[model samples]
Target: MSYLDTSDPQRPATAASDTNTAVTSHAPSDHIEMSEVVKKQSNGHGSVNVEEAQAQFHALARRLTRQSTQHNDKSGGDIEKQETFDLLEYLRTTSGKQDEAGFAKKHVGVTFENLRVTGVGGVKICERLMKCHDEFFLSPYYLAKSLVGGPSAAPKAILHSFNGAVHPGEMVLVLGRPGAGCSSFLKTITNQRGSFLSVDGDVRYAGFDAQEFGKRYAGQAAYNMEDDIHYPLLSVAQTLQFALKLKSPGRLLPEQTRAELNDEVLSTLLSMLNIAHTRNTVVGNEFVRGVSGGERKRVSIAEMMVSDIIMNNLLAANTCHQASRAVVCSWDNSTRGLDASTALDYAKSLRIMTDIFKLTTFVSLYQAGEGIYDQFDKVLLIDEGRQVYFGPAKEARAYMLSLGFRNMPRQTTADYLTGCTDPNERAFADGRSAADVPSTPDQLAQAFQQSKYWSRLVAERQTMQAEWQGEGDDPSGTKGQFLQANKEEKRKHVSRKDPHTVSFFGMVKTLVWRQWLLQIQDTVSHLRNVLKPSLIISL
Candidate 1:
């Protein structure tokens, strides 16, 4: 519903003019005179209800036009076609300038041809081709449509066509409920095939197809799913080393180079996610001694960052220049805001890095946190597979208030979003005044039950209990069975003779014989030496 009208720049102006003409023509003389006075005063003082005036004018014109004509079908269709063509042209032109040489190369010899044939011939040829290689011709969009039952079931619908181009570095938020197909939309953009749609829209990166976009831009865009950290059975240094090996390219680096890369990755990750203290700690199962929950999250993020860095470095080395752009998407469930020192340091470091690398980052926030809006250019609000709002974060509160929802006094964008999902409970949590509170306990209970907080907690507990019981029962049984088997095996083993006393007597007798042999050898050698000396003196 909240669509960007990027098409037809003259449409609004034409509508406004016609509406103004109709309104002025129909207004009473006294009312017209008063309107003139107000307009003149407003203009003089630089104050005007321009938007309302334009709307009123357009509405009046539309009413008059509806009464005057049945329909101009042919003209309307022609105008629409022209508009589409013009919009497409604008897209091509804008996209062309961004990467002129690339665009030229891609479109150089591409052409659409219409093959003429008598009905059945063309149909038969298409059928044969379809049967021959369906996989080759099938696209993600077509697959999604088939799975979802129809094109209408597909998540994306053109709300408003735009004439101007959407520039790079511009953030577009696609907000929707859990099952509203937002994830599908994203998947579509990534060219991931499945039963559901993730992202459904035309996306070009630097004048390349979606596949090419993935190759060129995917490395820059990091999509962090909401999953607990996976700690490998290794030390901190070993873990990073293995990660580097997996993510980094080429033969293993020299020891010094490896160490430097590791240190750099570790430091950047620590600064980015604000978890420097846990740099040396192991990240494994908590029951077996591992990092804290927050630290684990940071470690996972660090792994991702290291991957991106390696990707960028590889690309830079190949291209003979530095990679200058990056994007990251993180899904977090933590409601607590970052520490002040960490937040400040991150902001400063992010600015410096962005400047150094010319990075354009897009982070999607699904958790409750403060200052996230201030860091991004735009915020998109989606509810139930529809765009509720899309614009500046500062305007969000007013927009919600206009929708008959009360804004929390100290709530962040995430909190407000959560509240939107469950207004009554959020209101209660905020502790509304006595007069403003719901009248009955039933109402409050219903609100609380509907809150995401309660639902997520229940889900998490159920998962934990299931995992614990399943793992605990099997391990306990295995230990008991092993112990029983060991006892039985020991009892069945034959008893050995007591040989210690016999071995001790044998060792004493061997030692006495060796001492007697040594004394006789020493005396014989001394007598031989004395005989040799006496013979030499007689000669």
Candidate 2:
């Protein structure tokens, strides 16, 4: 873990924002190519002969490559040697590290630019009037499809000219109130495209195009939604075990090592999240008793923080063989319900994990406390559909001051910035009268663009992108920043067979044992539940 030597001469400081945060940029590059041999070996498909699968896979790869070349030529993108990854090499290195270290440095970097997302909001009342006729014998759906009548007329921009870069070992905070386009920004960056949304952007991960990032590099990035979803029937331990077993990189590590790592990760999560007491609690929903909401949010974080080695293996096993993993997690308002102390603890844990694992995390929180706010490496503030600011969290107040906005003395930065654009809070800072001061999100955005900070950022972006192509720009190169410092490390290698060492029978036995233990631990609660129903029936 301490293998990476980060004590080299400090690299040049990135663009300094008003908050003293460094802003860096990256250039867009090529797509990632998965080789036939690597693809075949990545997933454990034991039913077929390896040689035949390899041949078939190679044939398909050649054909696709040929077709892709023609398509790229037509699009005027040059046909260069495609960047390819070695599956065996990656597994040999990645699986062992993930098992022992809880995080495998995937050396992934994310860069997005000029992102614009447009979509129609809910149908207007006048449009709904047309839809009311749908209950009739002949559906308006035919007419709507033929003429492109309904949604086509109402399309509006949700995000316009959004831009940012997130490198590994950094936790970027996306801050905005409801409908300010923070969630949409995360979704567009992560390439979670939907039918309603029309997205235009250049998104790259680890130098590959975003489509490749989302498909082949499945585990490399994850979008954590606001709502935490889980099967309430499964206890915490059972749920975690199921995820680990199903997605574990098969044969990458010895059976014992994999098992040990799994235990270690689960235990660490319990301790970090302060949920050890509820390790066996069923993840109940509104219909049943279970862990509290704040505790459940921690569970969601744990799920996203699973080892990328196994995540990539899970995707590759499904034959979607462009390989990579959840090096980046874009969480949407994940700490909404937690108290200040708990949220601080949760944010601190994320910071620690990000440092150790070299994870690029994007979290959208509305009103974060000072403790949680200070933990962010960078901050992306979205106002309406425009980027209000993107830089260090600390310099935000100064940036605001330069923009004719004021932060009341002793007011927390989060509250001040969140409320600055409100019409009612207009104690103008830049000699403007309250009546003329910027109030709406749009006004704030305009004021920001007019400020000197905007010009500085644009200039900084040019320089940053120019110097980005060289080696060692990736934050992953800074080893032991979190996990180990000044400590040497050893390596372990294993086969595809090693990861698959755990069998179906083993899972069944393990699951049953875990379930029994959960029941035993919560015997009193279970008895009370059972007896309450019986007593009611008797009455």
Candidate 3:
């Protein structure tokens, strides 16, 4: 018989701190059983003090202990097996029950036509020399060169004419070689265009134009960078708690307060990612020793998801019928630090979230296995900033094959699609020569323009644009509904037109609280820094 020991669900175990280490005597897929018990115990105790909550929790734990002991005695031999709790499963089952406001029901999709991104490249030494007209010796020569034909920085096209749509409940895998603009494409779609020199395209989120989406529902779109960044001194729990606090929505679920809801969501996130045990551990960097890189990556993901949920609370406040999708996320090689199995698991987890939340997601991966590749609904292949292909994920291989590209033995579908970007790496099909197929990036781009995939994308975009135009009365579109609901959820002081549920002062207070929490968490580190100047002077 197996038992899940949730003796202290609030405080995660610190016994196994290593990210790579598996939970002892528990299968990875095993579901924890404390959610029901916790719900029952806390039913009427929502406003209970910390001490009272702890007392009730301990009582529940003891009851579970007695039950396990009784089962062990009946089975004889005094042996028992414990199962690791599955937080994602608990959330999945309890999601509908807790937030009848349709937190998981809202959906958001993204569509872009003729999407192009351009950026200025770094200056070379030669270009720098051309700017040395005021320098000591070569003033005359540099001046002459500057007057004649000085090197000037030109905008390099990072992404050109990329057209695609990712609807609610669908995940698209962006397959491309390094520097193929996969990252740029993601950044552009998420409206992170500040770094780029120019971005020209028609981008809409749930029928809301870029300006409207940015002003009203920007928080609903998130971009998860490849690198993980965190405060090295703060524990995973502290970091996530601060994020939840700052991003806390104006309204609360049924009978729960803001604090209570944050706690519940935080616990669920920690458990969902199976990092509850490492909640107390610091998210260390190169200077400190703490959570492993994989765990840190998971923390980053968990933090992003926390932000997503806050948006959900605002978006799903009303209009459950129109809120099928509300979040659009772009993940840029988010599985970079994980093992193959963990990477696949991460994709599967995203797939689950995409389905359950009705989210529109875009993920870019340089190295993805077949399992991970199959998790996505669509595939967009890029080469040298040009979109070579965009269509269904399963059809990608066949499309590449139709383009006279050969799939090598044991090559994954993701690999095969990415290999199409490299001339030396990709092989030609039988009886196909370089002349018979599209070879260069331009050729591939041109070929894609001629393919049925391009036609389908164009047709889809036209239909969507027509529908959006027909929604002239409701200019904000589907996401506009989310924004309107969010407005209603705002405080009396907050303007109905204001996008944020929290006021300016509220954000400042949350930030100050975070700083205090950080100082308390790492007093030793703070003391060392504070005393370092004095120590140096004494030395």
Model 1, 329-410: lDDT tens per residue? 3333221233432232233233222222323333344542343333343454544333444444445555444333455656
TM-score of 3: 0.73
> How many residue pairs clash in each candidate at the backbone level?
16, 12, 9
Clash-forming residue pairs, model 3: 106-323, 106-324, 106-325, 106-326, 107-324, 107-325, 107-326, 108-325, 108-326
TM-score of every prediction relative to native = 0.41, 0.63, 0.73
Residue-level lDDT tens digits of model 2 in 398-485? 6665555554766566666766655565366545554565566666666666655566665655544544444334433322211121
lDDT of 3 by residue, 150-220 (tens): 57777788988888876777888998888989999888888888899998988997678887877766666
TM-score-best of 1 and 2 = 2
Q: Determine which window of 10 residues in candidate 1 has minimal summed lDDT.
A: 107-116
Positional deviation of residue 388's Cα in model 1 after best superposition, in angstroms: 1.7
- Give the winner by TM-score: 3
Answer with 2 or 3, whichever has the higher lDDT: 3
